[model samples]
Target: MGTINELLVNIEQYRLLGYAAVFLLSFLESLAFVGTVVPGALFVVFAGSLAAKGFFDLGDLFWFAAAGAILGDGVSFRLGRRSTIYFSETNRLFKPSRLARGQEFFARYGGASVLFGRFNGLIRAVVPFVAGVAGMAAGRFYLWNVSGAVAWAASHLVAGYLLGTAWRTVEVWTTRFGALLAALVLVILGVYLLKRFFVRRGRLLLAFAGSLLGSVGEAIITNPDVRTFVAAHPRLCAFLAQRFDRQRFAGLPLTLLGVSFLYVLLLLGGVIEDLLASDPIVAVDTRLDNLLFAFREPTMVKLFLWVSQLGRGTIVVAVALTVCGILALWRRQRYILPFLVTLGGSTATALLGKVAFQRPRPAGVAVYREWSYSFPSGHAVIATALYGFVVYLLWRRTAQWGQRLNIFFAGLVLMLALGFSRLYLGVHFLSDVLGGYLLGLLWLIIGVSFAEWRRAEWGPVSAAVPFRSRAAGAVLLVGLLAFFIRTGMRALPAILPANGAAAATVTVPAAAIAEGLSRNRLPPYTESIAGDKQQPLSLVVAAGNEGALTAALRSGGWLPVEPVSFTTVARAAWQALGGGFPPVAPVAPAFWAGRPNDFGFARPLALAGGKPGREEARFWRTPLRTNGAAVYVGVAERIVGYEWGLFPRLGADLDRARDDLVRSLAGSGVVAVSRKIALSPPMTGETLAGTPFFSDGAAWFVEIRP
Candidate 1:
């Protein structure tokens, strides 16, 4: 590559001579023996790059390279036509076996091989020669040969030209602000157009990609060895055919059936591999978690929180019962079987997987907590099973392919959303969610297969009347409304436990208000709202109001952090990439009152060397008040970069932040009383990053002076 770049640089110095040089190089590159010794392809692309720089005309460069390639292949073809006399039978280049392979390739692809072979490295040299030896007509060779040469020339030249254009643009943007803006605008416009193009031709693009994959798959399936193995194991083939065929009852083709089964197996195998092996999937999951965490904001948090609740025990039960009742009343009673099998099977399987794998959840600061073992996320499992069954039922009743596709994708979106909710909430790892999805899908497939098989034997029954029956439809509508009501009504108390009557309603432990003080070396880590790992609820303020708490932290040299919105996140990411630690970095959410932290504050640390760190605290404004003062609960954590990777850890112990805060407050001459309070039952736990910690369940309570 370096040598090719140097060659291109030298060519740029000589204008007309450079075009001649490209023609010569491309000619030799296309010749039978000479092509193997020359780097013709790179030279052609380089010539194009130079043309883009305005050193030569792109059209002239293309025609010259293409003409060179044509002439080179013409020579190779004539050599092949006279091979018997020009070369010995023992000559390595004209060996019978090598010639036979080329003959076979030419036979398989026909004249089209002459055109397509130009793009392929080794084939470019041999195809023309072999075609001549195989008695291809001169007219036919010339037709494909010229066409292939033109295509090859145009492709490389255009690619190199575009790259050169981009390089020039970047060079200008470095010193010119206006040019930079222009470039950015162009990029945005290009992206918009590309997106529109894909959207308009999405089906065509998908079909093309699918066909390419299908071709490769067909080759593998039809291999002599594979055919022999299948022929010898007829039962195995039959079993796979039945398992994979979605429309087996309707006599779906064996190829389609096998493809469907293979796809499912691929997904299932991937999830299982991540669990059984310390695979790259784990790294991918962590990176995804970090990236998504970067996009945390109040709206998304609320949205996912609500969506995750759809898989909650109450909502799932209601939906399952409503759908089953409607089927039992207005349709065949046997239709209820799919609903039962999906829901029950998924739930049981997920539970068993949890016990069998015993995998722990990813440790992070979070807003929700679950006590169950976290191998396969129960939420992911339930959502896939329940919603998937709904899609199945909708598919059975719907006649239109478009409507069926819509229903299937909607269900898929919901299931994926629920699974993501588990990750965002910090209660499950990527593998766990993937495992749940696979497990749920497996169960749904089985249920649907059974339902389809039974229907095939008994003949199809009409179950489409539920849509026409207002009474049955009403049940589904009301059930859905109940789900909204349950989640909405439950949101505030869980998220925003504000002062006044609501404040008094919270169930604080009797010992919490005990008139005593307890001091431990370590404070108990607040249980993650999403309940993954434990971290210290390091600070509490008994201030006159929210404004007072804000003023106190600000006066103590802590800067208030912006809520995790898009702009703030982008800035933080940009700064982090440059090794600059933003003081107000985004905080992983921890829930109190079922709501995210109301505000975050951080102070930059000064280290003698190495990457700097930040001491950050996140606070929740509770509705509770003490002696006419508003109460705020806060957890503190520190951030430092990983030694090996770009991701930073939020589990850094900054216990000294407590002493520092005390000194800062005392330095301000603001007399405040400090009290130690127990926040949770005593236990030893780890952070999401696997940092082990033991806390005596203590939090600091500071009564601030006005």
Candidate 2:
């Protein structure tokens, strides 16, 4: 870490080398044949990220990358203009099939193919070569080539820069949120990559599948057994054929919708059954509620409160009316009835489910008091139904597959955000939101099926509405937007007060503290995100508050772990990279009862050959208390060395670290009283990070002096 820091500090000395590296990478990434083998784009992105950290100039990096990209493409174009022999069928790098696909792409898009193809990895390498071979004018080729190179450089570099800038913030929040933010990021990235893959290869995949299925279908129909069965049951075969006919709405489309409806209906039933049976899901709900309650920030609460209001009854109804008005003006009135029914039915279902179940909203943890029952979340239901219908309407009107996909994903994101807001605000449990989604999906499929049937029966409508009617639709949309803004402003004030409320504290009698520890009134071990047991609790401390407890540890030579921030993180990295250990390095968080430890402290250790080690401890404040003092349960371990010069490697002797902490506190002369007590049987376990540890399960009970 220190070595890397020093290099970054003096990076200007190697500015020329950095630029050359960037130029070469971008050049190779765009070069035909070579581009297919090199992962230059990834390196260019990393360079941009380094620039964001001040290791290089962003402008310089951009120019070098863009220039290299342009020159590389020009060279590939020249090579193509010179000869056709190298790109034959037998050439492994430039196969005839790949070249043919490139030619097709170029023919379809013309010179703009250069611009469009720049972003697609496989196509990027081949398009320039195809452009040159087609005898395209030099002027037109460079115009598109330069435009593409500049745009590509800017986009990739900007992405990397943003990621680098957000890394510090993500790191800090990750400790607080406990993998939630990280997991969310990974999911979003994965979805984006998957979407891109399908957009690029979907047509080819569909064509391939169609051919394969057609062949199989023909063989099946030609079979002797199949012919005999068909001859015996002509009516049954006709009915089956009619059901699968793609041209009719009541056929393949309706069958698919029916299947989807049944699947969602079953899921809804399962959620209801689990609720009634008090299953493990119910247990998870309580834990999650408590976890989110502990981690709520005022800023986040306000943000989610605003998001939640998007699903308000008035807002959804107003938007629905606006959409209906637009549809009527555009001669899409056939869709209006189904659309309204979908939203209305979903809302009614949620309200009815609430009344039938009478399930109370999460108590004490809720940011705002909700008067209605929470068996099925109204916000989740409305968001799903309203946005889902809107997506369907837009998808139906869109001709381009890409635009349709974008509309679908946009609606999906909105529905998910609104549903998540309800969870974040503590207004509903997991089961409630899930049930609402399933119920909403059920209605959505019905509404879409009906709309499709209507379209099929009535034939296509080509009547274009007048300019006046279109203008009126636009006005209605603007009015709806204005009303939505007004409603949001009014709703903000109602949730503001609730955001200021503190989480309620629980107290246990002093006499019960020891017995409670033995009986596991609190969890006996640390927890992972999935609620699995991790390291056992091996230390307990009683203090008036966190301040006194930290003070005693500080006096005993234990330094509090630094809170994650850019400067602290950089400093820690520098130290670790230089093979020097910092006393107050930030520690990776461990959870207990779904919440990360409330405090962390480490005592530096000197080892053989002057190596650095530390005794690390993490403590969580339990609901249990002794007299008026807060009770804290903790796990302790020894950091033996650095793992890959970044993460701290831990020692297996959990008991030794616990003993060291007790001895340090006892010798500090601040202890009122302290004793070792058996908390659990001897056990072995691994931490959330998968570091193995063993312990005698005996814990120190330390009371701090007043």
Worst 10 residues of 2 by lDDT: 169-178
Please give, for residues 1-706, the per-residue lDDT of candidate 2 as tens digits: 1224356656667878988988997898788755665566777787787776667788988999999999989988987888554657665466778878789999999999988988877778788988899999999999999999999898888878766655533432332332455455676776677567567655444554565578898999899999999999999999988887788887878887888899889878988987899765676676667667655666677778888888877888798889998998898999999998898888888889999999999876788878999989888888778889999998988878888877877787788889888888888988888888888898888899888888888887775668998899889989988997898887664543533445445665554566876555567778764466777788888998889989989988898998644456567768878888788977766777766777889889987788888888899877666767878889888988876575566888899898899889889898887887776788887765556789887788888888
TM-score of 1: 0.44
* Cand. 2 TM to true fold: 0.72
Q: Which regions of candidate 2 are displaced past 4 Å?
A: 1-97, 101-191, 278-280, 463-465, 493-512, 518-520, 562-586, 605-613
Number of the predicted model whose lDDT against the real structure is largest: 2
| Cα lDDT listed for each candidate | 0.67, 0.79
Ten contiguous residues with the weakest lDDT in model 1 = 514-523
lDDT of 1 by residue, 1-706 (tens): 1224455667667678988889998998888744643668878887777776677899999889999999999998998898753434554343455455566778889999988878866466778898888889999999999999989999999988876654543321121123223544565565555444444434444654565567886897889998998899999987865654556564454444345646765877767775688665665455445434433445556666877788788778878888887776666556688679878988998888888888776544344556789878888888777888888888888876556656766676678778877776666777788778878877777677667767777788864564557576786778678776866567522532112123332322223432221221222344332333356666667777778887888788778876554455556656767777778766555444334466778888765476777777778766455656766777766665532233455544445555566556557655377766666655566654444555555667787786
